[model samples]
Target: MSKRVLLPEDPRWMPFCKRYAGNIERFAIEVVGITPSYQQMELFGSVSPSRSRTSVASGHGTGKTAGIAVIVLWHQLCYPMSVTLLTANDMDQLKATVWKEIGISHERIRRGRHGWIAEHLEILADASCRIKGFEAIWFTESKTANEKTANKMAGRHGEWLLVIADEASTLPDAVLTTLSGALTEQHNRMLLTSQFTRNAGFFYRTQNELSIENGGEWNNLRFSSFDSPFVSDSSLKELWDQYDDDERNVRLLGISPQDSSKHMMNRKVAEAMYRRGRIIKDNENYGWLVLVDIASGEGLRDKSACILARVIGYGDMGPDARRVEMVKVPLLTNKIRSNTFAGYVSDNGAELSNVTYVIDSGGLGINVCQDLEDMNKVVHRVNWGNPCFKNINKDRYLNLRAQAMHQAARAAKDGRLSILTGDYRNQMLDQSARIPKTFTDKGRIRVPPKGATEWDGMGSPDLWDAVCFAFLEDVSYIVSGEIGMGGLVNSAADTALKRTEEMFSDV
Candidate 1:
């Protein structure tokens, strides 16, 4: 019988042995037959014996899980009996994704005739057993992952130990504390990575606040979908079309979404809330509602526009959501009379009976509202002269215009409103956002008549206010199937508040 020799014949036979242990990307390509793109290689380059801790913030589908799997195998096989602890925000995440990748590496290496595959790795322990989390020959798993898993960082010695915390956003500062103490070993490694979902906490601090460039602890690297060769251009475009600029930037470019200071109805929210299809389905469906902002003056003075919107969804979908949507917007013009406006709305997109009309009762809308009501076309008047707030927040708004606009802004901030993408979309967003507000003598928020002047060609944010009228006035019809007029909504306080809430509801 031939004796089993642990050593290989030549350098070419086992290239992994020739490569440095920290070269994770090389091991992935050479041994596992998996090639990482240039960006992935940069991530591997950041890993080294000298760099004890490394934190990576990455966008979606940048092969983070695959890279993680490669590193685990390389750390365990090359370092020889070194324990690699894997953890995440949740155990399901670890098991379904990171652990699955680990299993894939084990299977790939075994099939590829690599010496690393010669070793057997069975579950040495699990939560079902005496141990709380899973543990194998060169691995440990914990997802309750708080102080209990932090305790595992100690007592193990003999080989270089590596602690890999996946989705480090939720991994407590306690784990870092444990890692700090366990670094007594000369070759210990700690790797933390996650999608940049949060701009606070230890992950944020490690990645942004205290970076290696600033001579801080941990080598930090950020990878976007654009950086990864795995994501194709077509897929990138699809993502861009699907999400708002801020969301797409964060998801595809590894950029922070935004700080707190932004318009209530910013571009980020408009793009995000927008859906592909124009159709509204389900029981919540309300036929198109037309909102008319009457020109403050006749002929080229106050630009008049009518917005057609529908309730695609109803109620507070989340802590931050808007159930209303603007479907179509007609061109702006000067001095559209109530008769012409009524005829324009009925003929533009929706039929007379099938549609609901909410006309701004402020400005020079009294005649327009009276004309639309005379036409017997389900006209609901929105009195902007009333408090900007409604229901619970009535006291906080100077007038209904301010209330409607500010409410719409909150929806934008929370990613609750959706408007179709079009040339008018930009104009509408610009108008909605540009309306400056201030606290009145009575401590009420007031969006004054600033933009409807000669400076901006008397641009009254007509379409924007029309859109607001849809939410403040038309949405009540969607919820209760009723028509209302004057200052207050015709429905109960909860009904009006249900359509939209106060900006500072808690306050």
Candidate 2:
């Protein structure tokens, strides 16, 4: 193998290379001959050796394409044997915007004082950029990001690798994961830029996870079109007049689209909770409950799901201790017989006497609960189709199911609830996201019957049903009261506290 060449060490280029190795902004303005906007400059500053991961969410007219192209050129010119992989949601996007911008920037440098450096660099007909003699070692290449092209992004090892994911929000998770695998070296860097079109994705996670408010420790930049000097005030006014708040959020505010009014749970919130993946531990500050949402029939199409959930207590002082934590507690099988499930409960109940079993009393649930109760287990049977008891959310829900799901959705939105990672994670996320909501004739919040909704042809959302079942307001044992304080409640105090809890639940 031939020895690697270091471009910055050459006496002729040493001063120029040393000046720009740490400052990509100066390199873009002086070397690449382009003026970067304030937002773009901030992005350049944020991409340090220590923090190689930089995510940029920008509105339209922010010149993100130009910013990305300049960075690609900077990496190729300054670093030795560097490989820059440029990718977007589609091949057409590569040809139209960022790839086109790269060609323009390359020409600018080719005609400038640094024209000698651009002489060795070639933008091939195949859309690959490389130094003339060191074609194998130094280059920038474009690949359409998708499941089919994901493999092309992996195993890209080099001394200095820079992966630029343009329009990253539109790329699939598979492509992002593959691209992430390529950045294994310390010198390797990745830049993700996109309009915040959707809320749940790697791009969204980069922004949300690294936020200062979330106690994140990396660089996450947000740039609005209004902040860009190129976007005229008159054009912004036209955008404001043409679109509503949600539309303008994505187009001008550089923010993710807000949760739509239709879906009961936002996919982004659910994904964040899953990413958090905080496991629940048995403690004095929490009361555990077994929540079950059983399949209605004996068909193999539907499965019953059971979750171990907790109501947090006052003793815990941690920042996130106030939220409920849920785990997908196992059953005998996906399609467990009612008798077999009751047996499993009997086996586990001795170890968790303080925990109560709350089972849905619809279809097969009633029979299962009856069996458990006959076996001398205290079971709370909740009829989801029945009207919710009054004083809950000012009678906003049309039925108990709606009330439970609405509360659970609200808890997820408020960051007051978390679902631990498990074997059924993807299923749980899809199910939660597929929850459909409507208003009753009386304008009460209504979650449609499970049969009314379908996601990716999924039959019933067993896991999400268990989650919603866990959030039933009336059934949640108040951990601050006699029930949790001593794990036992005398009849008189129980009656009084139960009434009080009903009157002021979630207040």
How much lDDT does each candidate structure score?
0.61, 0.72
lDDT by residue for model 1 over 1-507, one digit each (tens)? 985333233244355555847677767876677778776677677665643778887776788888877777677656554576676657665676777777777678777757444343443324111111213344544545677767765545545677787777656778766665676667877788876554566777888756778778778888899868888889887666544444454567765545532233445555555553433332343445777787777446458788766654433324223456665667577745655666676566343225677876776677777776777767788877665333534644666676667667665554556676474766765676666544332224556565533224435567777777755622455343322222432334455575566655776
* Candidate number of the best lDDT: 2
lDDT per residue for candidate 2 within 130-158, as digits (tens), equals: 87677887889888778987887777887
* Model 2 lDDT on a 0 to 1 scale: 0.72
Count of backbone clashes, every candidate in sequence: 7, 0
Task: Supply the TM-score for candidate 2.
Answer: 0.51
Where model 1 places Cα greater than 4 Å from the true spot, the runs are 1-22, 115-119, 123-137, 152-158, 261-507
TM-score of each: 0.53, 0.51
Q: Which stretches of candidate 2 lie over 4 Å from their true place?
A: 1-11, 48-51, 210-217, 261-507
Error of 2 at 456 (Å): 8.9
